[model samples]
Target chain A: MKKILRTHILLFLLFALLLPSCMNEPVMPPNTNEGNFEALWKIIDTRYCYLDYKNINWDSIHDVYKTRLATDTTEFEFFDLLGDMLAELKDGHVNLSSNFDRSRYWNWYTDYPSNFSGSLISSSRYLGKDYRVAGGFMYQKIANDSIGYIYYGSFSDGFSDTNMWYIMNYFIDCKGLIIDVRDNGGGSLESAEALASYFFKNDTVTGYIRHKIGDGHSDFSSPQEIVTKANKKIQWQRPLIVLSNRLSYSATNDFINRIKASPNALVIGDQTGGGGGLPFSSELPNGWSIRFSASPMFDRDMQHTEWGIQPDIIDSLKVADVERGYDTIIEKAIKIINQSN
Target chain B: MKKAGFLILIIFFNVSVYSQTRNADTYLLSNVANTFGFGAISVLDPYLSPLQYNGIGLKYDNDNLRFLDTEKLNLSRQSKFTITAAEALNPAFTSLMMLVGANYQYGMYYHFQPISDLKVLAGGSCDVDFAVKYLPRNTNNPVNMDMSTNLNISAMAFYKLKLLKRDVQLQLSLQSPLLGCMFVPQTGASYYELFLLGNLTDAFHFSSLHNKRGFQSRLLLHVPFKRSNWHVGFDFNMLKYSANGAVYKKDDFGLVVGTTFDMISFSGRKNLPPSNFKSITE
Candidate 1:
């Protein structure tokens, strides 16, 4: 009986000792920000699933951060540091949080209009081609003329080869082609090159990619080649008018730049979105990834289009024009083609 | 006739004494139980023996050590120690048991240094490591690798309830870490070092109730799968750290095997000598 009682006491003591340790609380670090972004950064550096890009400086980057925290006064500076740190990783798919409303940028883009002078045909089919309508940009043929009129919404669908080919084919037999790229927030660069190839008979240098090294800079040329097996035949040799606006970006702007360089293509729109650089992605220690622009792209003319691409013929739109449903830009293109005929 | 009656009374008294001893053995055997046991063996040197008599068992074993890859950043090795104890609160209610366990681990890593900063803005050239070779320009030469330490202490309390005729056991555990820390450089120059600090600084605490409910039945074959006289089981856990706010967790399970000895005798059977045979016993 004494031995059993002793054993029970020992078990009770063990439970008493362990019970307190089980309900432990997380310890908050002293004098630190509410969210520990620094700690998150380390986690990414060590355990990211993949590491393809090279040239990461661990010490100097840390030193600069410490210096920034010590000397910087406002939260904006800290945000800038975070943004710059993310940019150093040089990937294009990552993004970070911002105090500003990114939605406002999209709203501003959707409200903008194209600057072209051509009237679109009312036929359901365009040059014997059909298109799917989601939200913006409708293409159709009009009666009494073989001209194809297209209303472009945005540049987000640059990765779709079918859409690019459809637009190109619709203008094959038209007397004049009206291509719309207004209010397009740029997407894929390869898509831009694919669309531009339809207009070129020979191989051409599309643009240059600028990468940053320490304090210096280097350039790599983005070359475009014609897809030989894509039924290499030109059915459209008519005048081509491209529509643009101030909201067009990266790939969209590149498309405009390529068309402007060609002799047969005419751009008629407002200034395009000034973003012409490729983005880079960085992984944070906290297991979150961020993306930002790391390089700028330039045309064959050595012209930097970071401030937005200007159209050959500038035609701005007013709010009243949208309410009337009368596209003055399309009307002007039709008039020009009619006069030439 | 009187002599014969006296002999009969003596025999009856002796029989009563023997019955009393047998009853005491049955009562004690019913109250006492062997709940669980655990053991493990690792391939990494120096070898840690699984036997408890060698002073290297589940409670005190620390022979194999490896780096904890948290966020793939700070590479460090941790030494862990664990001890577990359990008991039945009520012998009458044999289905209920209480378990308590404690775990402590200490880790350390060598120092890391950052080399160069690549400007990603404007038309700048991104550093190509294969094409360039450069060293730190700072006065204090970057430490090739210096040792840094971290520690984690955890404890758990659980209540296990047996159900379905003791075939399944359900356990509810409250777990928490008492100590957690990571060493950071004074100058704060390396991102890898900063990454380590973020993961190790927070002590994790939580409560989980789990049913280790598995169907365990005696097989009617010659295989060892037949219900054995003794059974043992074990659980292992692993924690992974990530810098980008992600966490990784892993676990391993093991079982124990042995024979059990019966402690009670029937009414008319004689008390046998304790089995001293070890070699030929199997």
Candidate 2:
């Protein structure tokens, strides 16, 4: 019996020792143009989260794009071809980056009215010379001091709760506040959620998210709830206006989605630029990296927010007003905050 | 009755081993060794990238060994701790992945001597390992952590001989993990939604022999010297597991150089050192 046991033990040890040698190394394509094309296609075919959601015929698209490649295509030509094919997804978050250039699909906002004027917003009529700044927020009392106006240009810029405390204290005597997020292209989702939490009355299930679980386009795990807990130390109680435009995107879109659910909050201006899918990146055989939407985020109703969110009040920048150093959207926001007061 | 007889036979064997050895050899010393190794490593974590990465690794290990029961010379214990770090790049040299890890293991072995020149030991061990892998270029999935605790079966053999007018020992040992519990988040879940937002459900799973297998083995030749014994050998490690729809692989082999020395600790009983055994502390 002891001999039998010893033999089994020795066999197990031999098996363990041999397994690493027997296992296959990870297989990847070579670094040719065709190899890179195949690698990029497979990465998107297996990992991109929105193929089935968007009803995109990726395999058919592959056939279409492959035919466009020439026998002697230049490096720039190949880059352009890849960029054009990616534009088919119409995602602003997706990009193909290399040492020379980056390809971006800008139609998500470029097709809409340029409702934002950088010069006009920073003019004497708004966010004037003495406008107080806290982190990413540029604020001053407007509408004859009855309303507080804050222009937050980028979600990428980090802000602390202490900054929020000071901003709230400065607006303590005001009737309402206007948060202009007109051209705030998104950055960190944590920043967006943190900014939204100041307005939440309690811990709220702000949204749901689904992650890819398999190679199949529709293979996704069950929705995971995203809860935005109210800042236990402080909460916004008065009327809050979230102003957005076609340039507000990604994390900015998420910020508006969470805050719009607050009973005391209203979204105004043009519909937001949508970039609701979470982006993940991978590499091609030639070493160029590709960013694509790999996770889909949704509102509390489980509805996709990729097409941008509608506003409670739609307004646009009138060119005539911009010539006079005034922002029509800001004036409209002032009127609404005045009425709410 | 047969089971009771078997248990008695084991106890008798253990006691008889002690009676056969001299008291000076059984009751007075412990062995400790420190080893450092450098070699190439190959890693393939599908969650990090589809391509396998190959690069250099550095490791440092410390082992403490002693008799578990002084009177029972056949029973012994070993405690080991190790730290390792590696950096690897993709085939195109466009991306880099870095991994740093630490491991600890403790076990006991029952010895067997079929011949006067050789000794064999079989034992069980428990170990814990923690590691982190980072890919600087991958967005939203830049980092993945590895945390696991495992129970393992281990064995070793020692052969004593005379070479070049000096006594030398050749030793071989293997440790294989059988069962473990590990943490591997669902593939494709962004860190923003999982960790920052505090969603930890379904992130841990039980890993068994079918899903996880690995072994750490070393073969060394120890040469006696005046102050301490110096050894040189090969150190190899291989670990791979399937979890959360992702496969993680790591294999490495390196040259190891180290020294082994014996230690003695007394509880103020004033035990005198045995003849030919010098104590520098004294």
Candidate 3:
């Protein structure tokens, strides 16, 4: 009996020691010559922590790639296959690099650079105090003729009531204002509100927030803060012209959408960046993080701003206009504003 | 009977002498080389109640322990050192261990441009020699290289507690090496300094100083295997990063579950208890 007990103890100890080694998975060197497509697939299979591809049809993407790999001979074909796959993901983080002529694609795609020589201003140093040459937050001085001009680079940050106070104070006396959110990639809605509030004096209907529920959707209007103090200083009544381009996005798009609904506002320039939603972050298993849109947004009139916001005046710029040093969009806006006056 | 007693006495004496000679504890306390390699005497001391093997028993000396003394002992140590010091004063007092580790890492800094737009916008800008351009009519271009070496020294300390006996460990680590400079060309300057220190093992082993970018803080919850020296855990980190002067600061968190194997062990000669076997036999 004693001998049996001792044998059992020894066996248990041996098993305990060997079990850990047996459980550990063997580490193998990665196959480098598996081709780019195979390598990418393997990486996603092994490294990607997320099980769900956000309801995206990954199998279809794989099937397309497999079909391409079977028959496609050209390198450009492979590149297009990868590009189409990435586009299906709809994730900004996922991208592929290929050796291809970029200038060919550049020539095919239309570029819109809004040519408006103007200064930018903010009420507080938080937004920016200095009047930069172009595409930076700057303060605008409203002239006695009730005309206001403000140039902004991007509207992604530094937008607050305090920061917008300077522009508001300047435009208090002006009848009309030119808000150049042309190249603004979009920022916070609070800054947009500061700009939007100037047009909509009544706090009753500001904007709306759209969110995704479990099965359906939901929408909520922004709360109103009554402006008790009357403008004893400067007061003007004229139409406002908001300058924009394809780069204008997020809060910038929201601003355009809201102002377009108003009776006294006009949107001028090309389409916007087509980003109109609240952003959210998600964690993947492979320790890679992704920030994406969580919910789709809409204006007061239940209009979605997803496929780029259309402007009132489709004042698109051309290369010929650039060569001639003519800002046709701004000139047209100025002309319209003058004609209205 | 007499012969057996004498044999026992001799065996005990020999074993004691051998054990004394093989004592790692003495070397750990007195040797300067061991101190530099591992750490000070306080760190080397055993924490848990030592288990008895055969006739010999090993026990931790807890009477002379002090925080300041441990800190002083660790002053001279440098490079790749792990100190796990725990304190539990009373029954009501919660047990806590402060774990700190440091390691020297060497790796390359890679700048990945996702799109070609960034490259065209950044690379097209050229530099002209102001002195020659304004005065002389010669066109001389200066050599320019965009890559640079980033040397960083990072140190972090965390307080860990065993939530359940060997099952879970909850830790909150303070971010460190918070300040470091990257040497890059003036034109291609971007703040890519965000680092998320994951696990204690990962922080010590795989973490590189140059790759410490795109995450400001991290929180880790380790789920350890019961009765096994292996753990598979999850991690979440917050990242604040920017590119092309566009700040994209968000709660960039991630989850990683990996297993760790503890392979380190201490080996030493056996110690024998004192005995008067010779006299008793006689």
Candidate 4:
């Protein structure tokens, strides 16, 4: 009887010992100069959301960059080469953050007109000294209280539902509300969604979001619906004009996408600098950080917006208007509001 | 597959015990333990942050031992659970990153006495690991997830001696992961693709010594009073797992303190005196 117990115990131990042999092949990429280069290339190749849409020849890009790699290449030089490789994707969300510098692509706004002039706004007394601050938004009555103007500079700053209630209530008497998001580089999605929800009375299916699921570049999961529910707070039912420019990006772009469906809303300004993908970060073998768009966000029509989103009514900044201390884009929106009233 | 493996192990043990000679005397022993630990952890995901963190943890352990032969062999099982919170920094130590983790393990052992004062045991165990690391200020890729399951080989030793004319028990044990499966995104894959999209292909990785290995060691001491005994011990644990160009490691050392109880014992013969096993309180 004791011998049987011993035999069973031995067999159990043997089974335990044999399990290790079944492990799958390792997927660890090497850590070298060429290794780091190949690693970055492969990551972007598989995970970056806009490769096919943007029509980038990733393999050709790899061939061009591989010649620059050497065993003795300096870390700084290697970083430059990697930065250049990433720039080919022409995405602002893609960056390489390091102790010395953070690489970026800004042609989304740089090559276009600077449709916003901050100095002119300050001098025009449009946002007077008494302009109230509601989270990231600064607001006041403009054109002699004929129209309500709210300039949202960024989405990073958070505001409570109470703050939104106060801002919309203060503008309740105005002919129309102008949401000026010029040069508003994006921040939090939650903040953007919260503000956008105020314009809708029902649950709105704003867009679709999907991410890479496998190692293959074309591998992706089914698109998930991105719904923006109506705000539980005070809703804004007045005529809404959303002012945008080349610098209105990321979540700001998402905000415009949300408000576009509103019948009372009109998007007027230069084309918006679009960043329609959610960015995720990674690291290289050398410990340098890499940030790239991992998930693709689409418009209601399921069209890609990585390049830029077209304005319903395109309006470029006039130097003449700036010199006269008037924002031409704001003037156009105010005229449209007054004409409608 | 994991459930099936667990059931097979249980059946194997039950059959082994049933086949053993029915000793006239048998005893059941159990103990509960609490441990507090401090440890350093490093996580390297080429697609996430490449920094290490340090943090504190709390652990709880429960052990049940049944002796079939007072001096020869016994069956034992241990369940341990732990939770940890840690942070990571850059070379300057100014930038901070954070992680919170939890682990639970269960081991079944068969003990045999090789010498008069020493008892050795061999066994197997299963463990589950879960963790989430958050970078306080990272905009896009701010959170990383770590989770896995492991089947391990475990061993233990016990010794009894007299200290200052009082009987004392000393015990040590080690458990090493031999085979397992874990969730690993390909070098650049995102959780959205794998979890939300159900891209499970290559998500469940087969892990072994080549890609994952680790050991946990525990040393415990038991002191007797008039009734139950006082238990105090130290524990050291280390684990390293690397796959898909990512590496994760954990090192922890802790102090344990608890108490022991003799829950139940049934003898085939009548009126058995209290157990004579010196490796644990009788």
Candidate closer to the true structure by lDDT (higher is better), 2 or 3? 2
Q: Which stretches of candidate 2 lie over 4 Å from their true place?
A: A1-13, A21-26, B1-29, B264-282
Ranking by lDDT: 2, 4, 1, 3
lDDT of each residue in A1-341, candidate 4, tens digit only: 45664585466445543433344332545667887788788778877878888889999999998987877888788788889999999999999877888889998899989899887666545786788898878889888887888888989988888888888788878989999988998988778888888888888888877767666677766777777788876688878999999999998998888888766789999888999888887666555677888888888888876766888899988889887778899889999999998
lDDT of 2 by residue, A53-163 (tens): 788999998999999988599888998888888888889978988777899999989999978888887887777799999999999988777888899989889999999
Instruction: Give me the candidate number with maximum DockQ.
Output: 2
lDDT of 3 at A148: 65
> A114-145, model 3: which lDDT tens digit per residue?
43433212322112354433323554543434
What DockQ class does candidate 2 belong to? acceptable
lDDT of 1 by residue, B1-282 (tens): 853453343222211111233232223231112333343311110000000111112322221222233232323232334344332211112111222334343323221222121101000010100001011211111121211122222112112234444533221111222222222221212222123213222222221111011111111111122455433334433222221122211122233333333343233336443445243423
List the candidate numbers ranked by TM-score, top first: 2, 4, 1, 3
lDDT of 1 at A2: 45
lDDT of 3: 0.38
Provide DockQ values for all models, in the order shown: 0.02, 0.42, 0.02, 0.17
True contacts kept of each: 0.00, 0.50, 0.00, 0.16
Q: Name the regions of candidate 4 deviating beyond 4 angstroms.
A: A1-32, A70-74, B1-30, B38-80, B87-97, B103-130, B136-138, B146-282
lDDT of 3 at A68: 61
Q: Candidate 3 at residue A38, lDDT?
A: 54
Query: For candidate 1, lDDT tens digit of each residue in A258-307?
Result: 77766567887688866655543332222223333444556666666665
